[model samples]
Target: MTPDLIILADTIHTMDDPPLAGPEDSQHVQAVAISGGVIAAVGTRQDAGQWQEADTQVVDLGSATLTPGLVDGHIHPVFGLDLTIGADLSSASSLDEVLALLQAEGRHDDGWLRGWGLNPNAFGTVPLHRSVLDRVTGDQPAFIRLFDGHSALANSRALELAGIHGRLEFDQASEVVCDADGVPTGLLLEAAAMELVQRHIPQESFAQRKARLGELLRDFARSGLTGGHIMDHSEESADLFHALEAEGELPLRLRAAPWCMPGSDEESWKELARSIGTGGRRWSIEAIKLFVDGTVDNGTAWLYEPDVRGESTAPFWPRPEEYSAAVRYFASRGIPTATHAIGDAGVDHVLTALESLRHEVPADVLRRTVHRIEHIETVPDDLVARFQGSGVVASMQPTHCTHYSLADHTDNWSTRLGPERADRAWRCRDLRDAGVTLAIGSDWPIAPFEPLPIMADARLRRRSGKPDQHPIAPSQALTARQALEGYTSHAAKAAGLWDISGSITVGKRADFTAFELDPLTTSPDEFAASSVLGTFVDGQIQFMLERHA
Candidate 1:
């Protein structure tokens, strides 16, 4: 068959073999021939002329570096649509600034005032309550989501709109956060609590959401992403994905996982199981996402011991044993899972649950299970050691460490866990050193989703832009190659799709990202600032810099 397209780059990091290996080691592979969305040939520059045909589209990324398409092991493009609505508070460093931005948005005449990406650190000594927000958004029903995505602060009007009068019980660890007088403080903790006010907020139109998603995915492609493992999937999410595909080809391929919440039962589990492999052309549901706990920053995370605030001692699931049963149900059937476990107790409970699967499931069935533990914000030495032979993928985000916390234990996440657990931080290098596959991602809307800057943060243990900042945990920093692998090879492993994706070998899918600088050879800082020349999915150019044309 005549090749559909051919791409030539100065260097191609196939990532199929050991470090520094490529398709043509003896002679740099100057050409990659693609036919029917798969790599047909990879050879020297001389072979490019022979592979060319009347219809072949050849793209020469002069002096650029080509590598396996970067995939975010975890992201929430669809859910983020709602979380990123209204004002963006990701840039505000102080509570004063947050209030000013919200006030500036002004009270919508018929709609609720909304904002997202509010950092908890901005609260400082002040408690996270709606009373402060009420000052700026009085009687307007304002709802602002914290940066963690696990909590929110609603103004009194919003709380009343949702009929949140006082403390309420939940199947999960979520709380209404009542004050000393048994009155709701407007601080909603976890998904269950946040949903109370969120459901009342005016949702955007489906057409609006679909358009936004398409634009977002194109931006993702321009940033060199060919695939993203969407961590959350709802019917609305599926609708959005299908609608985008109906209009045109999705810029990036997506593999999504629908959530299995605390109140779900056997029937719900079965329903989630049935969703597997269902999708449009470029998107599919391959796994189930569960949460063992919330986040440390909100004091909702299930830590081994209580945080300084005396919170975080409980698991998200009311019955921890039921969680293990759910895991076993999936594992025995060969279905994979990606669980969000942020605290030590949460991680331990998840690990212990997986460990029990060995005695319950047959060896062959167990061997086929590819379970992952996400966030892993803080874990003790013993829990970190458990992953070496456990076959559990560590799906972590470096920016969660570099962007959210501080070395001085001053950040909300660190201060909550206290010094001892804070010292553990995100042990990316330790997990890798312990023989665990550590997959990196942005957890977008929480952190910037650009792969290069995230990779740089993985190596620096601090943001690339702030060189003077002290590293959170220097020992946890990943090596240059390891950082790249986190987004490439290791990411595929996290999704159990390495055999078909992840690398540039012949016969594999022809998904690739071409960058102006070599990720492996360039310093992390320089690589983070570099530009993408092109990104391709299924052998089609999803995004190519206009300048390249």
Candidate 2:
């Protein structure tokens, strides 16, 4: 049978179990042939020639290293369209910089001042309040999403517009933080609280967002991502993915998980279950996303002990038992779950919940089910051990540790937890050594979405391209091989898609990422700077580094 497409590179990682063939340093397979969007042949260049016909489209990426396409274990492409609108404050380090950028952005003086990715460190000693931002915007009615995405800081005008006065109640662990005197501080914690002000802001048209998402996915492909596990799915997400796929081939294959929040009951769970597996060619809803707790920075995370601020002592679900039931309910029907559990107690609860299903389900069902804990930010030795021999995949963002916290125990994340817990940082190496499946991701809009830097940061234990910065728990660093596997092999294991994708085995889907240098052999710093030669999804070229008109 003639192959429809042939991809020939100098090196291929394969990332398979015994790796099919090739030494550890280089050369797994020099060429791969695809027929009907699946790998038909994987062998040397000479072998590829035998399978190709005259009409076979061949791409020769000379000197480039090909591997199973990189997939982000967690991302929020749909939700990010709204979060990333207005000013991009991701690079603004200080309050002065944030204000300067916001002032320039909202110079129009009439519209709402919006921003996303505002680092909590920018507040420094000052508390996060409207007064600080009110200084700049006056009455511009600003609503800025913090770097954590769990919280937002709104200006006085914006709060007034939302009719937020003093405090409000929410079924979830959400709070409209107020001062001792019963005045809204403009610090909204968790989703319910933030939506108060967010609803007042102007929204973009569906068509506008659809166009932007298409552009974003192509950018993700150019940055060497052939797939993503989207953690959050909106009501319009399926429509958006369908629209983009109808236009042409989607650059990245996306798997979305819609949230099952606290206020939801069994009926709500049933609704989500019915919506599962509804998608187009390149996208599908295969899993459910739930939150066990909010972030550590906002004092909403479900920590074993309160931070220095006397916060993070509660779970997002007011009734912790219901969270477990939600997991079990979905797991029984054979759907996987990816829950956001950052704090130690949150991690403990999720682990305990997964363990409860052992007797109910058969050993085979238990073995096959893939329930992951997203953002296992900090945990003691015992909890880390629970993941070993247990099917609970640890979905982590290495950049969260590398970019957010400081080694000195002074940053918000570290300062709150104090020295002992702070000493335990990300623990990527700890989990890997324990035989846990660790899938790496950017948790984009919260962190940068580039997979190269995320991979580099996993090994570096500090921000890539900023060697001058000290590593946050240097001992927790993963090896070059472990870091790459987190994005490929382990990521596939996390989503239970290891059989069909993840690696370049024959009969697997023809998804691949080509980089200028071999990811495994290249130095961490140099690898982070790799120019992606191209990204291919299902035997179709998403984009090429160099395009000829």
lDDT of each: 0.89, 0.89
Candidate 1 C-alpha lDDT tens digits along 1-549: 589999998787788745445446623876789999999988877888988999999898888888889999889999899889878998888889988999888866557888899998987788888889888876678889999999888989998999999989888888999989999988889888999988888777889898898899989998889999899999999888878888899998899988988878899899889999999999999988999999988887998789998989989999998888888888888889889999999999999998888999999987766899999998989998999999999999999998889999999888888899999999999999999988999999889999999999999999997889999989999999899899899988888888888888788899999989988889888889989888999999998887724
Q: What stretches of model 2 exceed 4 Å from their correct place?
A: 21-28, 107-110, 547-549
Q: Per-residue lDDT tens digits of candidate 2, residues 1-549?
A: 678999999988888864554333235478999999999988888888788899999999878889989999999999988789879888888888998999888743338888888999987888999998899988688989998999999999999899999888899999999999999999999899999888877788789899999999988998999999999887788788888888887888899999999978999999999878888888899899999999889999889999999999999999999999998898888888999999999999999999988867667766777999999889999999888988789999999998889988888999999899989888899999998889999998789999999999998998989989999989889998788898898889998989998888889999899999888889899999978889888899887898453
Superposed by TM-score, candidate 2 places the C-alpha of residue 81 at a distance from the truth, in angstroms, of 0.9
Off by over 4 Å in 1: 19-23
Error of 2 at 419 (Å): 0.8
lDDT of 1 at 494: 85
Worst 10 residues of 1 by lDDT: 18-27
Against the hidden true structure, what lDDT does model 1 obtain?
0.89
C-alpha root-mean-square deviation, candidate 2: 1.7
